[model samples]
Target chain A: MAKIKNLAELRKMREEQQKQLNLREKSNDPEKYVQIKVGMATSGIASGAKRIMDFLIVELDKRGIEAVVTQTGDMGYCYAEPTIEVTRPGEEPIVFGYVDTQRADEIIEKYIKNGELVEGIIPVNYESID
Target chain B: MAQQLKMQLLVCGGTGCRASESESIEAALARELKAHGLENEAKVITTGCFGFCEKGPIVKVHPDNTFYTQVTPADAREIVEEHVLKGRKVERLLYTDPENKEHVPDSRHMGFYRKQIRIALRNCGFINPENIDEYLARDGYEALGKCLAEMTPDAVIDIMKKSGLRGRGGGGFPTGLKWEITRKSVADQKYVVCNADEGDPGAFMDRSILEGDPHAILEAMAICGYAIGATKGLIYIRAEYPLAIKRLKIAIDQAMEYGLLGKNIFETGFDFDVELRYGAGAFVCGEETALIHSMEGSRGEPTFKPPFPSVEGYMGKPTNVNNVETFANVPIIINKGADWFASIGTERSKGTKVFALAGKINNVGLIEVPMGTTLREVIFEIGGGIKDGKEFKAVQTGGPSGGCLTQKHLDIPIEYETLVEAGSMMGSGGMIVMDEDDCMVSMAKFYLEFTVEESCGKCSPCRIGNKRLHEMLETVTEGKATMETLEKLKNLSNVIKDTSLCGLGQTAPNPVLSTLNNFWDEYLEHVEDHKCRAGACKSLMRYVIIPDNCVGCTACARNCPVNCISGERKQVHEIDQSTCIKCGTCMEKCKFNAIEIV
Candidate 1:
């Protein structure tokens, strides 16, 4: 809780923090987790994709959904931005598009929670080198 | 069980595409779908910029990925009827390769995108940046979590140092060195600042990223804080970027609620958070020192830097500042290891640089290419050559601060060192391609005018020097400047560049000097003959009608504002050279193949 007064103390603190960071990385299960991918290509952002991605995270947490979230460079379907791909343990990834905060919330409740496909489910329009 | 059916139309909504009225096309598509009773089956969704901006207003039909280009509002009904209802691809709207005239089915087949390796621009058009979980799913903060748990603050800094990532924010400062300096400097508080003040003309790379992938910046800054032992970050974005700022605010709020930003991020006890500070549209604030001063509620002016921001910045504390593009690259470098990044770019410039490829080029949008990519490839191959088949005169990299490079420098690799060697600096990646139609003298004058307006006036050299330089350019354009005036202009430019307090003032003369060196003949013609070679200087140009080609319907006379043309209806119009104001309205209005600029 004290302020670091010198370089030596700061160096010591940094080392101690690194040890803690190492432990966290070691414990993460990369394969067992569900992944959500958001498209962030230039076209995607212009279409308000950032807002949709933010909404999904907050709504998912409120509903106690356990998933790993991340952003990918343009998925080439810039036209279908604010695009989201939801992947569960045994299910094929379901990609949705043109998602807003409201649609994102509905997706969490109907599709993510109750296993129902709601509106705005954008089928992968184009084949990319996934 | 009822079969669930749904269709989505994703439209290219980037600025380049929008300029061609992509929004109108989107609206039309939605309206047609509804009219056809397929509104329930189809939903029109707007998304971020797909990088292939040349063939834009791009429409992709979902589930099948039928890529359509140049879709106007008129074609929206057919798209809804044929593509949505009949399930047939719209063959005419497909992008045909210029060389082979082959209809490219998908983005993968396009030559423009085949060579690109997107990192910083990774998430731009892909996901909703507002959604925190979507960002989480893409392994966004896994690097942050990984850094918090496994890596020491020193280790994180070490990895960044080894990554060979230089600042994309024009200065090319080593990212690792900056962090080390800030981390070493002892202060009651340290800060991480993301300079989103992208003021370079024709540059929108940072704006697109902030709009599409706000979280990437957030995640990168958090990682930066954890590495440098800083707990607070500030994003100094321009107020002009309304959409980018809105998304950034949303991303920040979402990160905080999900425990990604505030104390104990991923339970690591690293209390770091970010806040946004809007810049008042000052170009100087793009500089780190000026940016820090602006954040501290002071005038956005550059100061002498012996104690760099790394030693004492914003509110006089140790601070690390990186631009939007710089921070966008961090998460990848940390996640993929330093060697992976170092291997991608040239030996010295080790990463992809994003450019707002504008002016004369066919593809006027954001493009990210490797450091060693040639100017020729970017201008001709990727940009689809010059617009209207105009001859490539020169390409101006680094905005007003950078020099104009001609065809001789076309094949030179676009690295920072090579650009500098070519008499230009690889500034914040604004590559404005100029064609033969562009008057170099006038171009220089245009840029000088902009610099004159933007100078903060704190320093004498920039304020006074730029005003005088602008006046000289105006004189040259008006055919009133003498050879003596030209010499004075050159001398003043050198003094301003050498003595100016900040980057804004220092580089104000780049446009003038570069044009003078490359297009000295044009200037000579202007002074000696009082003629604008490109016919761009209105005062030096006159509109004349050729007798043979003119079947005069009085079109020119009717359109002339100053009554410069004295001719009856159905007679060849005679333009009175003495009375002519040289507005060129007569030339544009004349339907006959008669009007010529002399």
Candidate 2:
């Protein structure tokens, strides 16, 4: 990382970086990667979603799990907060609610690594556009 | 390579559910799964608010999207045994509609959420806000990327000006015009600011957005920086919002790491980064000038404005400031074109407004409805009418700074212009529904008291006018005021509104003026007849025990804290007016309906 001198050099460097980013994104199948989606919606944030999301990302890497993590807005379930939605290849995405750091660690070890369902599995009994 | 599968459980983590012990419910479900040796089989997650807040704590099992409402710790064992173990939906905990008693399996199909168009609250309960990648998946920075890649600084301002999206934080000022003013201003350094200092009582619309979607504000500010050619953004949030502040910090840090913020954003040569500045719980700081002053480490006070924040603000540089709710709507407007954003709201006021629907309303939560949605629809259809089947009297919009609108104004469309025309301004969209039991005279006094305390005392109008107004209200409510005092109140209110320096002093007289206009008869009755119709004014009200209805039940006598009630075994109880202290305990305790407020 070098200090950006002026706007022109900054634009050139950005263009090069964007090209690399596009190439990487194009080469890899986004859906194929183990997608870990956390609910950071207003209700979710009120319920401490940031802490759980932070815990999961750091812990997942520490545990040597190769996964792609991201955030989305409200899933409409404002009651159960700090919700995380995890999807593996060729399987339906599952949503877990009321996740803390302890639960995030368990989710990474059991659900992400061992392919097992952990506690706090909130069954989606409704139709959602997402 | 061995592929591993994962499960996601989305729980409604809104404040409504959290108060119902949703945290405990989450813990119990986890414990139960671990105990049953199925901990490896499931993963529990918490998400942002599910809209239906009444039947919370709501648990939704994803992939299947099984919606469970009113889940308790006691029901966790059964949920694990029945749902997780046997792969069957728990029949008991599922949400049953109150109208027809039919089980609603999906939240989308629920009658409550069928009409809602969730744009501001798009990523609230779905993605983890702490992760920048999840924001990326939802096309978060694509707008910023588009703005930087193709559009120039002036062009971005032009698009926003055409969008017609006004500020949602009380005053409906055009957001683009503010940006344009800031962009055109000559300054060596410029700044972008987010006003998360929401101080309106019972208003949590800003709080919910910050908690659920902090990334949106970050993204919007970054885009604003690119448009205004600023490299830094500051979010001045109240220290009271711990969850919101924490999430905002996390989101900012994560954005910096992902190259969404800091230096070049999305490889578009836009270097914008946001920092958090917490307020020490001052109500007046909600005003932009006051907010800028506070950020400059001065006491939160409003200054005389010829040069607004857009011209000269925040360390005396050209700054653009919008509240949390206003910034929340920016991303959607840019992503889905200006016309699409302009189409939903009223002719003048564009896009939806998020209201903290509270006070006697059934749906006591955060609701975002398009501007021009009638108060009747919001109160009756959406809010499910008043609690305990009470007659609707008035709906107070805009907190202490707004006027109280009666049932006559219910059909008037709720836009900035219409609301102001109806003797009320949409001050941050805090609609507090009041029933017939609420006394208008007393309500006016209550809001006046709030304004008097929150006044910055910089000017004479707010400081002196609020005191005089409060004294007059007190006199009227105490049955001591005359018609002459009423005239004084009217004259004083007008002077205050006209002479005030800032919005706080200007709108301080709204409650007094609006109440006097709508509930003039109520005030006259209190002064002329010396009677409080609602029995709310303690000085004017008296508790009388009726002999016919009294069965000599000693309940009222025993419950009276001041020992005001006296009666024989078989006769009626009498409340001694002198000793009563007007506590109304005897009135509440009389089971035989003996006691009445006169």
DockQ of each: 0.03, 0.03
lDDT of each: 0.80, 0.79
TM-score per candidate, chains pooled = 0.77, 0.79
lDDT of 2 at B282: 84
lDDT by residue for model 1 (B1-598), tens: 1111235677866666778898899899999987987675567766667766766778865544457888898999988776665445677998888889888865656767666778889866555566655465566676787788789999999999999899998879999999998899998899999999998888888988887789999989999998887999999999988878888898888878767788777666788999999999888889889899898899988899878999989899889999899999999898899999999889999989998888998877678898899998888888889999889999988998999999999999888898888888899989899898888899998888888888889999999999999999999998998999889888999999999998999999998998888888999888888988777888898778999888868888888889889877777779998899888798788777799988
Model 1 chain B poorest 10 in a row by lDDT? B1-10
lDDT tens readout by residue for model 2, A1-130:
3443333554555555442233123213446667777776556767777566657656665676656565566766667787889988778888888788888888888887778999988898987662
Q: What is the TM-score of candidate 2?
A: 0.79
